[model samples]
Target: MNINKIKNSKNNFKLIVITAYDALFAKLFEKESHMILVGDSLNMSFAGKPDTLSATLDQMIYHTNAVCTGAPSAFVICDMPFGSYINKDEALRNCIEVYSKTQAAAVKIEGGEDRADIIKHLTSNSIAVMGHIGLMPQYVRSEGGYLVRGKTAEDIEQLVKDAKAIEAAGAFSIVLEGVKTQAAREVTQAVNIPVIGIGAGNVTDGQVLVWSDMLGFFEDFKPKFVKRYLMGGEAVRKAVKQYAQEVQNGIFPSKEEEY
Candidate 1:
């Protein structure tokens, strides 16, 4: 079965994508989600890095391999880490490495118009592709920070151009990040392919979140778009506080494992 067809078919089935860093989560989610993205968001969510730029190709490949193993049948896609796709040859090489090493159905890169050449090169070689637009974290330096894009008419049109270019360049789908509500809808409607939204509102083909963010694992930082599903950080703190109190009172363990 063609994975790309799943995104375009009249089934009207909403694609569900989740970032899977390890085999366990991949195995668990594969059966449920339409796709599993071995996202480099692992930089912030897992490795405590400031953002996605910190994730290396090696680390990304390792997780991609793990996630693919768990997702025997799901469409697996790996994110090509920052700088891996700067030079044309390097981009192709990285795609080949992850495609061969992880057995992922596709690979996602953060760009729209500029990376159009890279997109064409990879897809031509039979590697499926996914496009990421909007708040590209990899461009944090050029963007001056991780703020939203396409607020003005000119910016919005430029965004639309980028999205279209990526789509026309053979990206099976585009990732619409941190854009206004109406603009997100326009892009989705305008593009024939899928648009996976993060902070881009709900009218797109799908929605995704970093697992840690949704679970509230990072207490010190929370993005505006993330809806906390579980307060893991809070729970951990409470448990640690309780353990400290028990240890101080000399009541820890309490003979639970005593012979």
Candidate 2:
């Protein structure tokens, strides 16, 4: 189904929008998801960058192309790199350049109230928009770290306003990430558009998790938001540890695998 149709399809169905970076994971997410976003969490999880803002436009386009090539039907979306879209005119131009790289169905940009104008400009021109709000990693420095948003009453009010503005600007969906469960639930209820949760909560219309977290890639820190589906890192570690032991014993190839 198309993006517009997806929202109308089921208000209660709860679509799954996953974060997949490469072709292999894209295929997996596409199989189980209604849509896939080539999120810039790659900077932290893949490139080993300290944060998301370090990701460059070229890197985002390159990985997004790979994902689009791998999953043709899942309405793939690429993330706009930091500083890629700011002013209305610059927003339009940068958005076009990214859309030209591959058949990515949309581009996700951070910010909410501040970016409403840009979102309107892009979506009005037929570029699908997925808005990111609450605990934006791209602003880690300004945020002083990845903390849960909307804790204070006034902050919650502001978040609600931001979410409503995003939907009014024609965003098909908004990501409510790393917020309190109550705030995430409130945001979901407040916005007409779909709310996709990361660390937000299960009450949202859809849920997205960085592929590495789902597949057990990160070793240093695990946020309370992500739930590991497969301990891939641990599995790999065990396999390699055993392999090392095998090599030392000269039993890896064994008798059967040998020609």
Candidate 3:
């Protein structure tokens, strides 16, 4: 799947993106999601870390490889983990490794205008880049904590500028996370590239969610934007409890045990 298809999907339909850290969930996402992201959120979702800042490039590459194998026909984007792309040369080198090792369609970096030069460098080297703005998880410690952005007029102005800069830098699409609805709408209209939202509301070009959050697998915490479709944690507990009971009661195997 070409990244251009995703770029062209704007305004036609709401592009669906879901994060997957392994082959099982990636295969499931392939059935419906337009794109599967090997997001740094996996640090929390898969590794039980406190936040995305702990994710490493090797972890991202390992998961991206799994996603690529599971969703061979789906467009896959891997997140450039924290500290992986702090400079142009470093960004290019790491992105190239990610692309070559995983065969993912693109690499997503969390930043706005500050990352334009890096984005330009990556694109110049034939690497596709996806931009992320608003409440960057990688910057959470510096920003103080998770918070919604674009509340004030000045903030909205900066957001629009950032979106344009990202587009100008050659990003095919941008993820607007934890942005106010009006600001998200403004950014979506401000740029020709697609804007995918997460807690940024429905006015953007598309929506994305961490697969574990959506499926109710991450029971420790839930964000306001996430709408759990299934109580997977509960379901798994129930199944496990039943199995344990069956085994203790000698109900396992039954007549089929003869086989």
Q: Estimate each model's TM-score.
A: 0.90, 0.94, 0.98
- Cα RMSD for candidate 3? 0.9
Q: What are the per-residue Cα lDDT tens digits for candidate 2 across 48-100?
A: 98888878889988999899878888788889988888798888888898888
lDDT digits (tens) for residues 1-259 of candidate 3: 4677788888888889999988888998897998899999999888999989888899999999998998899899999999999999999999989977987999999999999999999998998899999989999999999989999999999999998988999999999999999999999999988999999999999999998898898999899999999999999999999999999999986898767
- Residue-wise lDDT of candidate 1 within 1-259, one digit each (tens)? 2565656742286677778898988887877677788888898878888878878999998998888778778788898899999966888888898877778888998887889988988888877888998889899988899889878888888888888988788888887889987778878887888888899888888888877788888777888999998998999999999999999998886899567
The lDDT values for all models are: 0.84, 0.85, 0.92
Residue pairs clashing, model 1:
none
Query: Comparing 1 and 2 by lDDT, which wins?
Result: 2
Candidate 1 Cα deviation (angstroms), residue 146 = 0.7
Which candidate tops lDDT?
Answer: 3
For candidate 3, list the clashing residue pairs, or say none: none
Residue 168 of model 3, lDDT score: 94
Task: State candidate 2's TM-score.
Answer: 0.94
